[model samples]
Target chain A: MLTAFFRWMRLVLPRGDAILLAIALIASFELIGALVLLLNSKVSPVDLQLARTFFLALTAFVYGIYRVNEFHPLAKPDYRRWLETTPWTWRNPLPGGPVLLVPQDVVVLALLMGLNRDFSFQTLYIPVAFLSFYLANLMAINWLLGEWQLAYSTGFGLGLGGLVFRRPDYLLLIDLACYLLTRIAVQRSFRNFPWDDSHQPCAPIEASKLKGDSANHRLGWPYDSLTPAKLRIGFRLHDAICFAVLLGWWHLTLLWGADERVRFLIIALPLIAYVGIPLLRVFPYFYMHRSPIDVWGRIANSWWVIPKFDCVWIAPLSALMLNFLLLGWASWYEWTVRFRYFEVTLPTDWRYAVSISLAPVGTTAVSLALFLIGPKLEHWRLTGQHRIVFQRSQEFTEL
Target chain B: MIQLQQVTQHYGVRPVLRRIDLTIETGELVAIIGPNGMGKSTLLAVMAGILSPQHGKVIIDGMERKSTVEHELAIRRRTVFLPDKPWLPKNRTGREFLMGVGRLYDIPDDGLIDHVERLLNVFELEKEGDWPIRSYSAGQQKKIALSSALVTRAPIMLLDEPFSGGLDPSGILALKHILKHQVQQERATIVMSTPVPELLEELANRIVVMRQGEVIAYDTPTGLRSLSQCTGPLDEVIARLVHPRTMENLEHYFQERPKC
Candidate 1:
């Protein structure tokens, strides 16, 4: 059974390195949490319990959202086709028959259990809540797939059950029972899989959907209709606004909290979520578009050309300015509020300060590096040749 | 004239073109014929300035691609390249795509609309012209791509397997007519690559035969026939030149007749 489980895992999560990376990141986060707990010996047991619960709930929420999006009926038709053909029943007598758990479910359950200080009934509710949310999402998807009668009956029953119970424990039990029943129904549905014939065609294109000439007209300074310079400015403005909002939220939530460690996390989490997460997501697109030759070509002949400068220069400069603004605001808030108002002394460790300072510096350095090396990298990726050869040959021919 | 001097390219150690030296004159319809993975597409990409060669230079008339900003722009404005699998802007109508391409070349607004309409009609895409490219079938997408290239009205065109993308017989005939018209009326230079030699036999002024990243023969259709000593169709002559052992191998396999 264990071997079969491993085989199923291997089949589903084929990218071994990705799994390893996720594991490494999770372990590192746990290590940091442990260190914070150890350093802040003044933390009350109740506060610690509350923090753990918050972390678990956050994890479950993120996992639920991912499940909802990942299992959308219309997404990944090829994968769905494969799943339909594969034999997944307990009666099939295959090696991995009756495999129910997916990687996300296993990872979330393990994390919740591992992080809980007391292994009690409350810990059991975490996985149950997660499964209930995930299964409920799948039920909604079934309705979208045209199982209207079954969907309405199931939804009505669940709603009535929730109202009648009125107790938290009973509601959780009802959620679990409903989830199990739906899981069995989904398995049976997979056996038949009637939704294959209801494939949706591509969306029609209309003139109204296109960007109009009026939209392309200049709005104001740094807001042209179609230029890459304007795009860079707009992206920078967006980042600035997002960072300011996150900063405001952080202040509102954690300003009165007495625990220094929690306060530190309050500041750090927003920075990681807003600036770091967005950078991670957008960097690939940025790198692909950062070709110097293409940028120069567009700037030279484009309708809305920036005079006396290339648009390629804008991205790196904008990135640097945004990072400076974020780091400056963070430092100001740290000094003015945390140190002065809360009487929280700056860390004597120097390593903490150095690491925090290095985050923005490192980001700026990477942006500059991308600006300098991006064209060559793009050329290499596209044509599979060292750019130096083209550079030298062009020079030789010119001479 | 378009000149490629010792143009060499590779995809990660797998050489696609090796020291390719060729020149194409103005108003010439040149067809590059080869088997799969013989660098027909790579040669066209090099000419189009879409892929920079590692060792050689591509020169259009007097201006060299990648020389300077102005020089590159000048070369690009005069040349329009249609890749083997052209990626159309998904959300835009076919008419809008053609209009966008026309605008990029600085065509007059009055001329642009007329040219777009004519191209759409020529390719039998008039009914679907107003529809978005995302909803187009494979053949329709190919027609739209061809239409966009035609709308540019550039002096030089580099097309890679323009006919292989689900084009029906009538669409192929329409494309052939358009190619001939461009060469005759506008003195446009066209360099197209195809695996099928039959398409090029009647259309091409000169045929360039490639094998394993090297150009083996560059001649007229009759010249190729005489050189290969095959008085049959150009397809047979190409098979003789590129895959001489193919017939012998097939004969041996059939004679042996191994049981399945």
Candidate 2:
């Protein structure tokens, strides 16, 4: 039945889109369920089962169709043409290349199977170990030459490895190996993933061609190739804005007499990335995107993966995580070490726009004024050559 | 001046253009007309420095014949090459798109808006100019593309199938008028490739005929029509020359095969 369902799916969605939609649906379900639990306090066993069945059913349908679409082979000439000039840059690798399924990353599915249970480090340890082991292995590979593909391979391999294992011991060894490897491996590939330089912004003509390829053979998703640098910058910007707003809220609380320790935690994390990371930069990198442990949920099937389940999730998640970590560190420092050093206040009315922030009624009117006048004051500054990269949609349209 | 000396281009094992020698002087209005798939677009791309020749050299304004990355970007900036279908920034309004382009080319402020407004009015797009190009019809999109190319006012212009889909009679006339004006005022050289021969009869100073990746003749439209001994009109002359009888004979063999 699953195979039959997959066969039909191949006809409708391309592999890249399929993977994207799968991540989206899974994340939506998780988020919706979480929202329900938050609002209702009691989500039934039947509700949980229904959600799991829906997720598995959707995955089966998507994966099956993607596999069927993968059958018809592309011409050698065309494939070679794609490889040499398909514009699969380090920034945004086209999803048309050969897809290597790292079976280890499938272990994350095990976590999904056990999602409703209490936190069992022992039960969860196998998948974590698998994730860490492969992540470590790739870190070692990355240290040798900062090979991004291998680094990703390690993460995917470990994650998938945990799922196939029935016993924790088998998972433990693989996880241990990956962990040790990550600890010993040099972390030179860690940096910002430049979103501007990504395939999103760089409109290379050939990129559009690869977008039409079959599912498994299609190039990896865009966020799959985001560099560490771009991710860091995105995170810092988002977190800084969120932290400022949080502070503003805390300050307002002071007027209302609810000022507390959480305010201090917000101000202390600046030293962590600037001082600690550099000092311990060589230490085993254990941050999200590279972290082996699961947070509240599996990132693969969480709200975190929504924007980029295809490619959107990575940018936002990376931004959110980086900010969260940095701000968390700052908050830690303020609470433990510098209680009397600063006074932060919350705004009388919240000005920051969180994912759920409400905007002022006249924001659009204000924006239009800025837009009209902004070009008048600005001289044509050459921000290098404005490059246009075509999306996959363009090739079909061009024809 | 754009010069192509013994240029060759291939699509895999099949050669699309043979050793072709051609030159367009500065400010010359050169039109390349041919049957389909005869490397007209390829030639334009090669001349625009978009495609490097498989063999031989393309010298632009006395430069040594080599295509460098900088030279390509420089050529693209200085010369506007409009593909058959123009690339429109769908999210941007026609006015915004033109303004952004004008700014990119270092056109002065205040003047940019006025210049774009004038062009928009002339193209009968005054009402739609303020709206995003996504709302534009096919004809409007073409006009926008042509308007973009015109606004750039680059020294060299390469247009491929510029008249394919769009253009009212008045719009066509306006475009011709603009092209002529650009040549006279800016001393801009224009190379346009179109399937339609009659369209260029009044405008083109020189029409180069291409067939099967080679330029069979390069002369004025009148001269080519007079010289060719082909049976039909200009399109037929192009068709016969591009697909010689030898290849068409293969069609008979395919047709004879039994149906499955």
Candidate 3:
């Protein structure tokens, strides 16, 4: 019985080198804890809390990344190719072993819980953080691999996480729900076993080294002239909305759950998203592009706008305005979030969380809508109200 | 057979190809001729299914283009369209590109490699075929592109500006004979547009005369020759049919040349 348990532990844990690394990490943390004790009679409550939080967050992140990498075969080309040829299905014990959490996982969590036992029920927080990221990443992979179900795992985990500070009992239900839902999503994804180019790591042709002499290979306009650039077929409006809502939910949870310093990280992200995304995406189509007529020429001819071409900018511009409105709400509303006021000890209110969350939603929405709502890239490039000038390297351009 | 029924296309308010109605039989070599901006390429594009006509339909083997997924795929398998500046993969060797195109058309693997070699020799690209297409000269690029279209062995070939894109004298001559052979032996229907009236007269079974986005005339070489009332070769007659006042324009152009 003991041998069976040890074998199960071997399957659950990291390899030999990784195990040594984990031990070294725990020893370093213990050293830090000993230093605190040596310096003072006892560590301050605030310092103790901060140290535990940082360590838990770090451990959970590493654990989540390790599991996602190990359990997922798509990360490794050899495993993925082998799985494709095999008759093995997810119904069988994964050949590598069970992907779902077992008693072995509980023992690992129990060890972590024992280490950080000063805080009451700190065990629950470790599981919540580890499972949240693990499931979140898996669900994303699952969605990419063809399963459409998303957010159920991370949503319950992150949503209940904010309330966990006051009500730890409620988190137990979420932990259970997240695991079950994620398993379903993973099972559905596995059903799409023979994954295609969408999920598999695409071999970069530009970086490819073909057989034969690499000399005399030219680039640029050669390929572009033939295939042409059609920016039309990417993400669509609904996809943007879906992505935006998820980002917003993440922001909402983070705001309610984190300290003042972490809240500042989200502020620049949305702002950068608002200005940066549009410039990167929509501006490229219009930059140095040959318009059939200038603004003055259009005005003179009474041809005000080219709907097909002009419509491309609508998504980016509307999303910007919407983001501006959201910022305005955050700045002026009941629970105001002011930049550079982190030192002032501002109140962390529910209204502030909801207001700030809108920015992430708007930003993600803008980026996606700009990409997807289209006269397909081919249609736009071929028949757009512009001329395509040949570059110096371009012998000929087909538009 | 390839059929275009009332095909009209436009990018904006202004039309590129105006309500074109045309029929091309199997094994026929048709040439589209017109002045610049007369929609020769646009009409060909509509027929190639690259551009869907705003009005009317393109019918190939009684299967409408882009009508249903299965029909479109089947039609695509049986047809090959080479734009004047068709793209070539930069990293791929010329032979590799040809092999890829052959496979795309579902040609048998055992036969495809040999066919690619023969096509390379025909284009005088035996040595360069081992090199990447990106390193090819403009004329060489044109030859490889033409070879790619030929390698498909599709029943229908739509080539736009094949002669003028960039081909040496020998390259042009080789293409003329290869297209003729494809028609005579393989029973392939070819529609090409070129400024070279002499080449058109030599190879084309029928001639399509276009002007201002419309097909003004469609007939055989002898029929067009007689219709223009020219006793000499079809070249001079082509000038008259393409533009009615060619003699008047030439006389005036030379007379006005010194003054300008």
Candidate 4:
């Protein structure tokens, strides 16, 4: 019966991990027993108990990592490929292993919790460590696959749990909600099996024979050019999710009374990204790449601005101007600094909007300038002409 | 088609390519003749995607070069760049290198092996072909490198200083004929940078004479001769166009009387 129960406790762990886990089980109890004997007035019993529980939690974190590594189809490219070739659907059990959290996973977590249980809420760390590790991996898998909605949901949920530091119950509730959502994410993601370009960001297996690194092949011309990994896809709808999360953090920080510098920093960090990203794009688009007929050159030669092609600059210039105008408003109104005074008191509604909404609102304006308001790339390529000139040495003394 | 638009390349603050905009259509064999340090190799390197230009895009076959994974892989498979000094597997034999390169481009084994053997005979490296690259002479190494590029059967070829790489007279003749056959028979696009324009006279569809990182003249051999107002050899026409003061300097040298 004991052997059967132990077998039931094994979820995603392989033979090596199972053996190591047995050793860890021995270590956990031995360390606790040793600490109890070695206890002194200086080392409190509570600290000893906490240390023993912390060891179990750390092990659970490792298990969480292994769980995702072994369980997720995205983690195993070979299995994923095989699954694609087979006439398999989400309805059937995966040929290799389970996708969703199984009863065995709960038994594993419950076993860890049982080992270090103190009847206090502090024992929640074991489950949190396991699930946090699991969901974090899930979040990354989704993020890499471009499921930004799920990624941000897990990220924001995890972040919110961290923010409510004192409440274990709130963390556990959020973790449960995240787990259920992850199960939904798993189902949704699995439905799109044999995914095209599903990025595998996991650690490489050192022993794999057929697998080779970048160093193995000489990625020279045409291959290098045609397959360059450097293309930037600017401002997807997912930017809105990230922008909301940043602002949400700001709101939570303010409502919960974080440090003044920290409060300002949360908004300021993203504000830099908002302003800086568009500036980087617009600057490159204009820097040396000028209109075939510049405003000054055209005004001088033809005495006309030439709205036909010159309109290309309007969106970038407007983004810049709008940024300055918004920044100027931010400066004059003293939105970020005003929060210092409300260190203990509750912030008012319009002021909250002005201060907290600054980063996201500015980002939206900038993103719209880049994505929505455009002499679109396809149109610009077919029509727009640019005057290109660079410094060339006239004196050639060589044969 | 290979299009370079507003491409600028530099080393430190010194510009090697200054806003180079050139389009080489399919099946066109263009020769880049320029003075040393005048961006001849740099131009080929940029088009080959060995180096990304600071300010523009390289569009090939209606796809922007290096823009995406598929585009890059497709471009790589179709294009082959033979640098002046190509890195060879020192431990591998010349035939092995050629076969490996052919296989890399997914050429069938039977044909690839036959092609490697034929390339070995044509280049006159039949004996050295079986010997490791480290055991070969510089000229023999160049032959193998050229053969490697040929084995790929790539539609687009970028050869930087192909004729200057310690190639023997027979090897040079073989390469010239092979390049001509590729362009004429196979309709391959080749852009090669060679200091010697005389070698490219009949082979070249067009010649771009570059001076101080600038394309001073880009036209057919005849057009270049006429543009420089010299109905002489391509070398003289390019010399007149690229270094107009060289003749004047030579005249001054000849006119001067030695006091001693």
Chain A alone, TM-score for each of the models? Answer: 0.39, 0.20, 0.68, 0.58
What Cα-based lDDT does every candidate model obtain?
0.60, 0.51, 0.68, 0.69
Report the Cα lDDT for residue A157, model 4. 75
Could you tell me every candidate's TM-score relative to the true structure?
0.47, 0.41, 0.62, 0.62
Question: Between 1 and 2, whose lDDT is larger?
Answer: 1
Best by DockQ: 4
**Candidate 3 clash pair list:** A226-B87, A230-A377, A231-A377, A232-A377, A235-A372
TM-score of chain B of each: 0.94, 0.85, 0.95, 0.96
TM-score of 1: 0.47
Tens-place lDDT per residue, model 3, B1-260, is 99999987765557678788999999999999888888988888777766656568889988987665456656777888887766566667888777766655667768988999998998899999999777888899889888888987889999999887669999999999999999999999999997668887679999999888988889998888788887667778777887889877999989889753
| Model 4 per-residue lDDT tens digits across residues A152-232 | 777777767746645666778888888887777777877776675523222221211112221233322222223212223
Model 1 per-residue lDDT tens digits across residues A1-399: 988866655533425675576567556666766777789988766666666655665566555545555554334444454555665443442232222445646765676667766576556556655665666666666554545445444554455343333244655676666666566655555555534332211111121122233112111110011111101111223333333333343243332232446544543544444445334533433332323223433444342442212333444445545555554444444342255446754554443454345444434343443344233322222232212112121111110
Q: How much is A182 displaced in model 4, in angstroms?
A: 1.8
Model 3 chain B: lowest-lDDT 10 consecutive positions: B66-75
Candidate 3's displacement at residue A388, Å, is: 9.3
